[model samples]
Structure formats: structure tokens, C-alpha cells
Target: MPLILFNKPFQVLCQFSPQEGRESLADYLAIPNIYPAGRLDADSEGLMLLTDDGKLQHKIAHPDHKEAKTYLVQVDGVVDAAALARLQAPLDLGDFVTKPCKAVQIAEPAWLWPRNPPIRARADKPTSWIAITLEEGKNRQVRRMTAAVGLPTLRLMRSSIGAFSLATHPLMPGEFVEVEAEALRVGG
Candidate 1:
């Protein structure tokens, strides 16, 4: 069984199969047997782990394991400390209250690659970046959380999962790398 790390690109589906003429995991990864440990939405991009080992997948995806998933989010408007603080607290989302999470502004640099189609820019409004981490994997949780805090997410990317961080292995949109099971098993 192999443990793999992928730097998922924006608009790419997490599954190996195709979707409605759009890109899928098949296009980026050729390895067999390994499946995504968890998932990143089609609209989001960044670090995703894959494994042929079912137990590893369960450990990573099961909410009870409480694996922290980190994301780099670009949102509409200039987010302030109050909004960041709100994100750090429990969020009432009507259906359920989100668990406490970390949120902080990130420094911007010109080196950040541009999205293929690019995020929409509002002439009258500004945008900001935020780094968020969550233990639970709810559908579109980061985007929803930002919206709940009066900040709409313009772009979202998962930067790291557990001990694997995109910082150490920066990947272009669809690139992936194989990892030793021993490496991933350490932090979990």
C-alpha cells in the first residue's frame, strides 16, 4: 500500500473518475489502488492525501480522529481581527455550530500563482487572505464560515494535512508525489 500526496488544482474533482466533461483525478494521477483519504471540493484546491491502505484513509477522514486540515483562503473585503476572532469561535450555521477553529491573515506575495480563470475582483470592494484550520469536514465549511462572518470566500486552497505541508513540497495545480507510509504514520 502506498501513501501519496497531491497538490490538487482548482476546479479538479477529488475522485479518479471524470465529471461532466471537467477534469478529474485520472488526469493528474496514474497510480492504481490508492484512493483519496479525504476530499477537496471541485472549487477548492491544495494538499490531498491518497492511500491504498484503507485504515490510513479512515484515520485521516474520520471526524473522530480529529485530523486538522489547514487552508489558505482568499476572501472578499479586508478582514480584520474581529472577523478573524469570530472565525476562531463557534459559528452558528443554522444546521449546526462549527467547532472552534484557527483563523489568521496571511501576508501576500507576488509569487503566488494565478488561478486559471482567475477570481473575480470587485472594483468597489477589496479582498483579503486568511488561513483557517478545521477538525471537521463539512461541505464547503470554510466558505460558509467566512460568509457567516460577513466575509465571502473568493478562493480557497488546502495548504496542509497533518504533517504534510505544501510549504515543503510546493506543487503546481495537478502535481503529486509518493510518500513512504512511515512518514505519514508518524504524526497520526
Candidate 2:
């Protein structure tokens, strides 16, 4: 079985198949039979895992597995302690209540690459970076949670999922590296 770690770029679809004019993993990945373990929205960027093993994919993607996914978020405001607290608490996103997770303000990571086309800038408002870890992967959950707490997410990047991290296996945007399948299995 093949396990690949890819650094997904902004505006790139998560799947390996073609998607009209928009860019997809096919543009960068040509490894047949491997599919993305989890998805990142077109607007989001960073580490993504791909695999041919179904069980490993399930272990990585399933919410019941409770594998923590860490995101480095840049929001459009100075996030105070109160705001961080709100982010750490169980947030009600109307459709579902988010499970309590780790949220902390972090200095910008040096490894980060500037996004192409760039995030919108506000001459008056400032931006802050925060690291948030969530076990449940809801659709656009991080963005919604930050917005609910009065901070709008400007950029979101999944830096790690469980023990697999972008730091440990570095890949620039649109680049990928293959890893052993056993290395990714939970507690393997």
C-alpha cells in the first residue's frame, strides 16, 4: 500500500481527478490508485494525506477515530484571551455543537509560505494567528467557529493530523512525498 503526504496549495481541489478549469491533485499527483485520505477545501492549504489502503484512509478521515487535526489559522482581528477561551469551548454552530478542543495564540510559523493571490487586507484591522486542534472534521468548521466567536478566518491551514505532521515530512505547496502505510496507521 502507498501512503503519500502532499502539501496542498491554495485553490486546489483535494481530489486527484480533473475538475474542469479549477486545479486538482491530478495537476501535481500522478500516482494511480491512491486517493486523498481526507479533504481540504479549495480555499484551504497545507498537509494532506493520500493512500491506497482503505483502512488507513478510514483511520485518518473518520470522526469516530477522534484523530486530532491541528490547524494554523490567521483571523482578521487581534484575538484576545476571551476570544481564545470561546474558541476552546464547545461552540454551537447551529447545526452542531463542536467538541471542546485546544486553541491557543501562536506566533506565525517560519515554515509557512505566502499564499498566492493573498488573503484580503484591511488597512485598519489587524490579523492574528491561532492554532486550533479539533477531532471532528465538520464542513468548514474552523472558519465557522472563528466567525461565531467574532473573529473571521483569513487563512486556514491543516498543519497536522494526529501524529502525521507537515513539519515531520516537509513538502512545499503542490509537492508530495511517499511514506510507509504502517507509519500512518493509528498506534502503528
Which ranges in model 1 have alpha carbons more than 4 Å from their true place? 109-111, 185-188
- For each candidate in the order shown, give its overall lDDT on alpha carbons: 0.86, 0.89
Each prediction's TM-score versus the true structure: 0.93, 0.95
TM accuracy, model 1: 0.93
Compare the candidates by TM-score and give the number of the best one: 2
After superposing candidate 2, which stretches have Cα over 4 Å from the reference?
185-188
Tens-digit lDDT track of model 1 for 1-188: 65788988888888987778889999988988888988989899889999988888888888887778888999988999999999999999888899999998997534467888898877999899999999897988999999999999998989888778788877777888887767553335
Task: Write model 2 residue lDDT over 89-159, tens digit each, in one string.
Answer: 99899999999999999998998988998888888999999999998889999999999999999999999
